[model samples]
Target: MTDASIPSDGKWIPQAMSVKYLAKAKTALRAVASGEKVDWDTSGEKTVPVEVFDEDGQRVFTAEITMNVKLN
Candidate 1:
């Protein structure tokens, strides 16, 4: 079972993401990111978890993003 959950806080938020890896992954996923060959774990899909923290060192929010691998 996939136990994926996101927090509901107003503090934590997303600022930016790694466009380089994303663009590379989109262009030639197997050749650029994972390696020359296709890796199962990173072959088709991926899930990215983002954590938001406050100045007091507490978890405020959580965000998850699913990346679809496009092999061309």
Candidate 2:
């Protein structure tokens, strides 16, 4: 049986050169969703409130990145 290849963990790349950027930093429906264009700065920081959920669907983490160095 051939083993399926998993996706990458994510690495920095040029914003224009990039085709997509996954926003898996949140889980709540009211939080960041897929295919959502967020505002970022030169430091590549997007000010968004995130709420993470556990395996049991319980809110676990709430992160507010002071400086998210994700330069597309």
Candidate 3:
């Protein structure tokens, strides 16, 4: 699972996301910012759980992103 942490009032800077999932990540991030349910699908055989933590160390956002290969 890929994870990240963000401080309160901080913005998300895209890392290695490609064009396809980058857009989806932005949308999901927006929904998470608004406290709405995230509707995302990995659409791949493997799942990568992306977690975002608040400055207070609380979990804020979570989504199972897609990955090409499975991790051991």
Query: Which one is best on TM-score?
Result: 1
lDDT string for model 2 (1-72, tens) is 001111233223322211122344354333332213343323443343455554456555554432233433
Candidate 3 positional error at 20, Å: 18
Sequence-dependent TM-score of model 3 = 0.32
TM-score list, all predictions: 0.37, 0.31, 0.32
lDDT of 1 at 29: 16
Native-vs-model 1 lDDT?
0.34
Error of 1 at 37 (Å): 18
The regions of model 3 sitting more than 4 angstroms off are 1-44, 70-72
Residue-wise lDDT of candidate 1 within 1-72, one digit each (tens)?
Answer: 012222222122233444222211212112112222323233334445555444544444454544444332
Q: Give the 10-residue window scoring lowest on summed lDDT in candidate 2.
A: 1-10
For 1-72, candidate 3 gives per-residue lDDT tens digits of: 122222233333223332223222222232232212322222223333455554455555556543343222
Off by over 4 Å in 2: 1-37, 41-45, 68-72
lDDT of each: 0.34, 0.35, 0.34
RMSD of each: 17.9, 12.7, 13.5
| Total backbone clashes of candidate 1, pairs 3 or more residues apart or in separate chains | 0
